[model samples]
Target: MTEKTIFPTRLKNNDYKFTVWAPKARSVRLLAESPKLEITMNKEEFGYWSLIVSGIDAGTRYRYELDGNNSFPDPASLSQPDGVHEASEVIDIHDFEWTDDEWVNIPLDRMIQYELHTGTFSAEGTFEGVIARLDYLKNLGVNTIELLPVAQFSGFRNWGYDGVYPFAVHDGYGGAKELMKLVNTCHQKGIAVILDVVYNHFGPEGNYVSNFGDYFSGKYSTPWGEPLNFDDTNSDEVKNYFLQNALMWCRDFHIDGLRLDAVHAIYDFSAEHIMKQLAGKLDELSQQTEKPYYLIAESNLNDVRYISSHSKGGYGLNGQWSDDFHHAIHALATNETRGYYEDFGTPEQLSKAIKQAFVFDGLYSKYRKKTYGNSTKNNSGEQFVIFSQNHDQVGNRKHGERLISLSSFEMAKLVAGCMFVSPNVPMLFMGEEYGERNPFYYFVSHLDEELNRLVNEGRKEEFKTFFDDKGEAVNPASEEAFERSKLSWGIQKNPEYQSMYNYYKKLIELRKNHPVLQVPDKDKLTITENGKGFTLHRWQGDRQILAFMNFDQNDTELEVPFNQSGNMDKILDSTSTNWNGKGETSPQKIIAGETIKVAKEAILIYSN
Candidate 1:
């Protein structure tokens, strides 16, 4: 199951064992630093050039010289201490002292995911800086921290998907050493670390993989440009190249899981798909490490085949980002009717998303004007990670509007309540728990001026057809745009913020303490939509729970449903004065057929 550890030019017994794949090159050489050493590499079969040189060890900075004149950073670089354009550093993966010896598997079912962008999550924008907030995150009931890409990208500020070197951790995020420390600290605090990785395409800047060999295909087209050469000639090595990167994250960094970005955009047409190969390798890694390692895909396909088991002729992944759920609630709460939101915005869609995993399961998508999604045959609800808001949902907008700015405070609580009580793994964006209102604009730094201008234009042009002013918004290439996306940590301490934060904390506690909320069984859940709103029903054996949300502006009475009629006890009411809302006492106990007063945009949770 484990892949062969290749490239990396390891140092053993005072000699540097150099190895690289450069098929397109006529000649290749190693230019090492600290002693100014150069060795003529032997071009072996399959275009692999390698040579064992003496007097080079850990911390030995080096670069691959192509055609005896042009030097580029190693494609399998361990560290890029001097930034992406500079020489790559030879690192000893075993040198870092880890403290997670007793650390085992973090069960997927017990996870409360918190998605964060490293640069924006903390002021320092480094892996070490994340440690300071571990206590805060641990107390916030987030068992797992799903970081956006930390790989070395073009600039100090980016979403991380633009990373060119898959193995090199970004220097801004404390490099490889600081990343190790972050993972170690997370494990020490009983938290799992899930790393986000990009493989669909490399960033436009500092990408030199094509100089050595064919890493991209001229045939396949993607939104970003040429797709990865997964099925082209010499693609076996290419697949191994990315597979080695995935293994490096889990095996070298001790990361618990990986979230693959935009798999739908990863065009691979082969009998043995690249994703299936990667998933199979992960199975080997999970068993070898004896940890419950996980693989999540951010797929827009909405096909259950992504998470289906290998035996079922599909890529066996852990879960995928269920945008259907986010869209359902977002359209319901905000009432936006542009772009993809134009097809949603209905109570029935929200109900379908809750009861079934995907709202568009095999149905015709009006937005696409075609059939969308496949039935999730036997896939559990927990296989989908549902969230009220995420970096993509909020940051990709015209002005990067968050739910707090788009919806009422009561509606925010209602959406958050659904996320907590739903029978699915829930995730929270970095500042969503405290209702931070800063925008998460998409920004990047490209050294190429012409390319940078094109990137800005493309971003604006894509939004023009569906949005009015979305195309004429702020330029993402500017420095001020990146600064504006940074989280305003001070505002989180306000009384208004604390009230919602405390509600989130208690809701997480409710999920952790109760078994019914943790188990995501679609068959055990039910949803009913009325003229006023909808009531979701959840049950386990003798215990039962019902969550009601009133969307009507005027207060209305909702009928509760239960097969075995009994008095339902109130657990949490968002209308209470404690939440700085209208103080209305929803009866502590109500019979199955009895009605309960539901305030405007009010959220009520009852257990029996």
Candidate 2:
């Protein structure tokens, strides 16, 4: 089951060839617009119908009629021009000119990811609008920009997780041409693009896949509803539906990588799991293209098995998102211990997260009231994607409070310093570098009135543990909520905000060029704390670096000496007044027995 066997495929003469898997269809018809043609499609083995129409070339609007009665957009549509509820437009992916031949992505060890929602990232909220901010990201030293899903979700403004049409790019985002242009521009700017794709469920509106075939299962259910029928009868075609979408994004769209969203919700009980198959397909495609195609998973399960090699009976994914790092840092920095943060907030927990990607490895979980997680099995730092803040951490909150609103200026810098210095790959939420004041709230434009009401009510109920007293929830269905979430690019003009922005760039520069920070040996990275401060030591070949950080509001002294055989050289000092701090500049050196003094809520690094 390759390209033409399932999706829209064009012939050598440039005519259109369309194929769809409709297992339970009594009659299938290709109803095309422009000329108003209703051509009968021929049936094939395993319940597939296809038609080769000569006159209907690319950019033709079409839909399928079931039994000459019900009509729905193609499940594999490339572009929904009118809307998801309307007809799907035909698109020839080869028509677009791509200029990424000279673009080669940097290694994962040197990656600095920046996550952004295209809608709220700019006022225009289009793919072209993102191009205006590319220079800003490039100047900020970000080598990667991970976009929240851009697939054809209902309406214009969404966080994009509720995408119903998996194949089409949202028409509101300037459609396929503009999206490809954005991808090309990112590669040219030395920034790799990772698209966050959701396969667990579709949005509550305009989803018609289940009408044509047995696409859902009754055995296993997800938070959204019945999961995709992966282990059920007639599921082979359903599996191909999602599998083809993965190959299309990589081989067709030139996406450097994909961030598989909420993999925990993808319930599959089969001999060959969907993740393994998807990873295997991408691996094969990568070899053909001669460019690395990464498959990163967003599984909050904290199970390293998701990223482990398939040969060892694991999924063999390139990386998985690490919630432990954020939870540990948030608890320590903000002292919030009401919800999931109840299990975090100690130097030991943070130390464990730094040493191993998971803090609760087969340990007891107060959140679930049971034991949870397993050992990472000592996976490489590249296998774990760590971030101080991301979409879910910000947008899922009752108030959509970002780290800037939760921590102080110096604390924010310290958080950045520690993340960049760590061995794990680091990511930053959009507007975090520039200190954007606005929140990244969750907003959607579902066409169904009742569905939208339930979603808004459920969202408010979920955050009951966060607020001391519940107030009327900000209507997620409101246009104002979505408008307010847009990134405030104005903060870059303020001097203090500019300093914070520069500090982030400086940290990224150190991460890219510094030898000690480039080291991937997690075993060589050590953390120890006494009272309100901790010291982290890292070594790579002949290069060694030591960092002293104080978490207390008052100055804290490191008990151990930092002389390191009298070969130490000052590297980074977050306490300097240059960073808008009240602390003095760091000293050139410290004698063998002299204890290092660290300014409150700051970090200092030295190299040897």
**lDDT by residue for model 1 (1-608), tens:** 22345556445475667778899988998899997888789988777888888777778888999887899999888778777899998877767899998999577878899999888888877777689899988998989999999888886768887888888888878888889999999999999999999989998787889998888988877787678999888887788889998988998899999999999988788788888888888888888877777999998889888899888878888899899999998898888888899889988988888877688888988888888898875888778899988988887887888998998888888889988888888999989988888888888877667877897888788778656654466677788778898888764568778888888888899888776887777789888888758788888888888888886655555544444487778899987777767776678877866666677788898898
Q: Which stretches of model 1 miss by more than 4 angstroms?
A: 1-4, 9-14, 470-472, 553-564
Q: Across residues 21-129, which tens digit of lDDT does each residue of candidate 2 receive?
A: 8878988999998768998899988788988888877778999999889889998889888888999888888888888998767677778899998888888999889
What range of 10 consecutive residues in model 2 has the weakest lDDT sum? Answer: 554-563
**Model 1, backbone clash pairs (residues 3+ apart or across chains), number:** 0
After superposition, candidate 2 runs with Cα above 4 Å error? 1-5, 468-470, 554-560
User: Clashes in model 2: which pairs?
Assistant: none
Candidate 1 accuracy as lDDT: 0.84
